[model samples]
Target: MLTYTPPIAEQRFVLQNIVKVDELSGHNVFADVTSDLVDAILEGAGQFAAGEFAPLNRVGDEVGSKWSPEGVTTPPGFKEAYGAYVEGGWGTLTGPTEYGGQGLPLSLSSVVMEDLGSANMAFSLIMMLSPAAVEALKHHGTEEQRRTWMPKLVTGEWNGTMNLTEPQAGSDVGALKTRAVPQGDGTYRIKGQKIFITFGEHDLTDNIVHLVLARTPDAPEGTRGISLFLVPKFRLNDDGTPGEFNDVRCVSIEHKMGIHASPTCVMSYGDRDDCVGWLVGEEQGGMRAMFTMMNNARLNVGLQGVSIAERATQAATRYARERVQSAKAGSASRESVRIIEHADVRRMLLRMKALTQAARALAYYAAGLTDRGQLGDADAQARVDLLTPLVKAYGTDVGVEVTSLGVQVHGGMGYIEETGAAQHYRDARISPIYEGTNGIQAADLVGRKLGLEGGAVLASLLSDMRAGAAGEAPLMALIEDCEAVAGHLATSSTDDRMAAAYPFLTLLSVAVCGWLMALQLRAAEREDGDSRFLAMKKAAARFYLDQVVPETRGLRAAAMAPAESLFGLDEEAFSA
Candidate 1:
């Protein structure tokens, strides 16, 4: 049935030890955040996730969300689960204090999100998109706009969605044809169709605030002409309550391979030619405002990878321990033993555990850095810009790989729908493709991020890796490889850089992950308490360094491969 144990202990280890989240308490922003508070938050969230969300995962996937002209109906029990989530104040974790929120660190909220996503990945999307909208409005919206919308959105009474994709404009935001004409009053008449909008239409919240991108009548062509608008499903009254229908219609929802409970809607704005929206920023500043929301989502999407992988790993491990299969290779007993006793099964389980922990560390580190950056650390912000793509691309990639391994661990039973292993893999497949496809993330890594601060960002990261490596030969070698390939791509042509993007991203991500894991190992080793959890940390870190991190060597080679090899025979050569 795919039970999840919350992994609170592991999350604590990463938060307190690896990321040194406790250190953030010294800052005025996180002054009230004591270690005890962190522990209590983790414990409370863990219980809520296990008790409320875990049991509904199978049902959510099996029944999915039902759609009609009225609106989208979430699977049974989903509405109640969402109610509990809202009433419990779960969505207000990292929100601003002025808008009736707790104003906690992004790092803390990230762990809570990991727990929620682990319990129910499909259902968690309802909570994930709201805070991002709050962030967008907080950063780019006017004072009146923030006062009007931020409170309910922060409180989870309303949900938010980023409406950017059209039938023709997928990744290319410049190609969207959505129009927003100024209405002489404060609002604009918005007319467009947006596809693949997650949580676009759902029954969980009363109002859905859509941050949409459209172009003005006299706007220039392409992305420069695009502008962001705050459009709601129902127009607000003078008292800030949902009043009238705003012509925001859900034409239909998509039937997909995974996250069936998350409604990916084909949304039509101004079907009646009366939909009203307010400009978020300037007339042609949509891309800037949208990126604020997207960057937040990209990190959470990376955490989604870690969350699903953790769930899948636990499921696979539990099955391995209970399902009796074959005798051990060197055992004398003829009777069948648990599959976990088999060396190969042990190998797969270890790999899953190692990769899951590594990805979690990477994502958490990025989140923690975000908190630091928010506190006005310029260097931390620069480092964060570099790590965002790595966390997004590599973290989601690990989710897909680890979930696939979970299926392989279950063997024939994994293929059966009843076992629930298949769902994890299916759900994970979308993470790499959405929130900016992993390929685009990789391209961003090599093309843009690699050149941050005129190459100083990469250099700073390498210096940290060197310090973390602490003369460990394998880790040091991988760091050198990352540096070499990064240098090669710097001087390479556009085609060459694009060709090497994916591999370089993988290489650099592994190097950074290796450094983080090494830090965890050192922390574990230094602890005086001889606990089994600490022992597990040491082992996972060792395995990651010994086994997984070494893949960087080959990736470095691929990163350095000439673009000529890719272009030698381009058009129709394969068919010939």
Candidate 2:
């Protein structure tokens, strides 16, 4: 079986030294996190992910999740592994201490997530859902709601799901048709069919808190009228244990391209007309509340991209080191040499490592900004607003590319299921599509985020990226292209903006990741560290700068092209 060895050293190096969780230690939310505690936590999370979760990745993919009249049954060992996970308080890393959580910085939680994703992407998802719900509830839940559900959800005794997508509504959440009828006692009877609900109907927990988006009878039209509701699978008893079954039912789950172990269900609310939901924030305020969870969820999905890349890289590099192939170019003997000795194989391995490492650093940096933003840093909030989309779109794009390279490295064996390279590729396919498609993310960067503070955020961000590129000529050249593209995006017409957003976002993402990778190298040079690892870090930065950074030129040109051709395509012409 293929295995995952957590990059504990690299994680600690980034968190403790580079991103420096200590910067946020001054905040009350992060006050309890000491260096010793943080180290222990990282080590523990790594152990859990590798020893417990990694062993389950293949099993989960093969067995997948099973559904029946009794609900969903997870692949074997998932429930037990999750049980151990919660018992060890792994779920509490980012939860609030008031609700029995550790309250460490999100950057720390981000590192833990990397480990978990590397181990078992499907299983890590169940853990991810609760946290998004926790964030929404933590920010929007009423006192009674918090007191009742926060502890259970945070501790992983229960799970949660986001219910927004329907048959007709996908990204255009404003088109949703779910309805809510006020029951006069501050409760609402919710009736809707929500699709792509992960962990929606599963035996992992008796009570699954689903945050649903619905429309009230008297509410206005469009997204402005949608309201958020907290609907539990099992009705709560007077004493807090699950009482009767709520009207939430799993109609079916998706037979997807990847992450099969994760049950993506089509959920029906009020199937029996008895489904009761309490308002989460206020009526006609669902989109606002959902975005709160989504911005962070977008980040989580981006990290999934990073996780898959790490797993694929590890598998491919291992195979390269062991798989004996052609002898070195100048070798005299007829003896076969390991693939790692071949130049092209080494290039592929280094490229995979470079992109994965850059993506990881960029993700960790964005997560650090998340904590800073939460701590009332206005600049950090602006940074988060801008970086979130790029992280999701670019990170996942790199993930797909890197995983494909992993398959390339494995040669014939990669095509076979037993090598496990294909699984990472299959699992990564969903990251760019979910939590807002990469296209939407790019448009968000170009249209919404670029307009922040009358375009000062994008301008200032580019300025800093240029400054960071100080001595690196390739990065400097890329920064210039990115800055020019930003200028075009800032002034482009709506049609042009829509056409160029994707390439613009890709160029900017590459520049930013290159910048972060540069930062990692400088930090490595300054700090007293492991020589071999530090050398590897410098080498990765070099590869990213030299081999991968040139794509920005082409991306910039495509981004600057006219939108007319795209708009001119006829429906039938487009189909061809």
Candidate 3:
């Protein structure tokens, strides 16, 4: 069995030096968070994830979740482990202090999330979705709604689930048919079926709060008429206790390829035409409100990719070190060598490490940006917005690649169910597809992020890269190439520009990741001791720049080309 350990030191370095988390100390919201406090939190979280959560990973996968006509039940020990997690205050790490939360910066929370995902991603989804619900309430809910739900949610006494995807409507919200008819008592009667709802109806919590998207009776056709609602599985009494059943029931659970312990439910609302729900925000603004949670979910999904890749890398690296195979070429002795001694195996392992580290840096850097957007300097917030889509899209895409590589490194064992590497590969597949697919993320990168402030954010980012080079010959050459690409991308017309958007986004992500790694290398050089850390950073950065950054040349050309090439490709050519 593979034992998972988080690279906490690397995470801390990224948070402290690359993202400058210390600067957030002065902010009113972040005044309580200090470096020592954050470190302590991470230490405890790392230990718990490795010791407690990780042990259940294989067991949960083997036993899986059992679904009956009554409800879904997780594997044994999950309930206990989750209780310990909540008791430790891990669930409320990033919630607002006013609502029974620890009020820590999301950067710190994200590090903990990475560890949890590494241990067991299916288990982590429960906590992940709850905070998302809290965020939605915090942003758009009425004062009454906040007062009623925030404390329970933030305290983890009750869990939450996002109810968006239905059987008929998966990605296209416009096709949703869930109906919420207005009632006389400032509530709505909701009737619909929701599928693939994680933690949809679990016995782990006292109650489940669902942030459901449904259409009002008067709602116009399409997404414009969608409204957000707060529907609880168990109704709350006047004294804040669990009351009558709210008419929400889980009809079935999906038989998934991975993450079996986490229930993916098909829930039917208002089977009795009595499911009561409260309006979250103004009527017909559900899509806007949902974006608040969607953005967070998207970023976290990217972290899922990072977490799985890290776990897979750890497992593969350990296997390579212990598994003996054929001798090296031209060896005098016939004794077998460890697999890691083989050139091909080393190459595979190195690629795994390089890609995983690069993705980690990117994901953590994005977390820092999210924190900065909320608590950093003005210019920092701008950079965070620009990088959000790239981080979410690119990081998760890389996650699928890296985790897949992990399985490949294991050879035949990787394909077998018992080896566990296959699970990482399967779980990671959903990350790039869900929470908005990578393609949608690319579209968002070009459609919204790249065009922000008429492209000033990207321009400023390029300028910062140039400034970071500071006349160093090697760095300067890379900076000059990146600038040239940026220049070409900047001048392209809209029709021609759409053709380049995806590749441009890819280039921008690789360039930014390379820049961050380079900075890490320089900082590691100046520090005393920990030469291994610095050396690894330098090697990873070198690999990224030498191998990965060159891909930008092709991306740049594609972005700068006329639109005809993409649009002109015959549809029939894509057929077999």
Report every candidate's CA lDDT.
0.92, 0.89, 0.82
Task: For each candidate in turn, give its C-alpha RMSD to the true structure in angstroms.
Answer: 1.0, 1.3, 2.3
Candidate with best TM-score = 1
How many clashing residue pairs, candidate 3?
0
Model 3 TM-score, all chains together: 0.94
Clashing pairs in 3: none
Candidate 1 residue lDDT tens string, 212-279: 99999989999999999999999988888899999999999999999998999999999889999999
Q: How badly does each model clash, as a count of residue pairs?
A: 1, 0, 0
TM-score of each: 0.99, 0.98, 0.94
Scored by lDDT, the top model is 1
Residues 398-450 of candidate 2 have per-residue lDDT tens digits of: 89999999999999999899999999999999999998999999989888998
Q: Over 4 Å off in model 1, which ranges?
A: 574-576
Would you give me the overall lDDT of model 1? 0.92
lDDT of 3 by residue, 135-196 (tens): 89999998888989998898788998899988887888888999999888899999999988
Q: What number of backbone clashes does candidate 2 have, counting pairs of residues 3 or more apart or in separate chains?
A: 0
Among all windows of ten consecutive residues in candidate 3, which has the lowest summed lDDT?
469-478
Error of 3 at 244 (Å): 1.0
Q: Rank the candidates by TM-score, best first.
A: 1, 2, 3
Models sorted by lDDT, best on top: 1, 2, 3
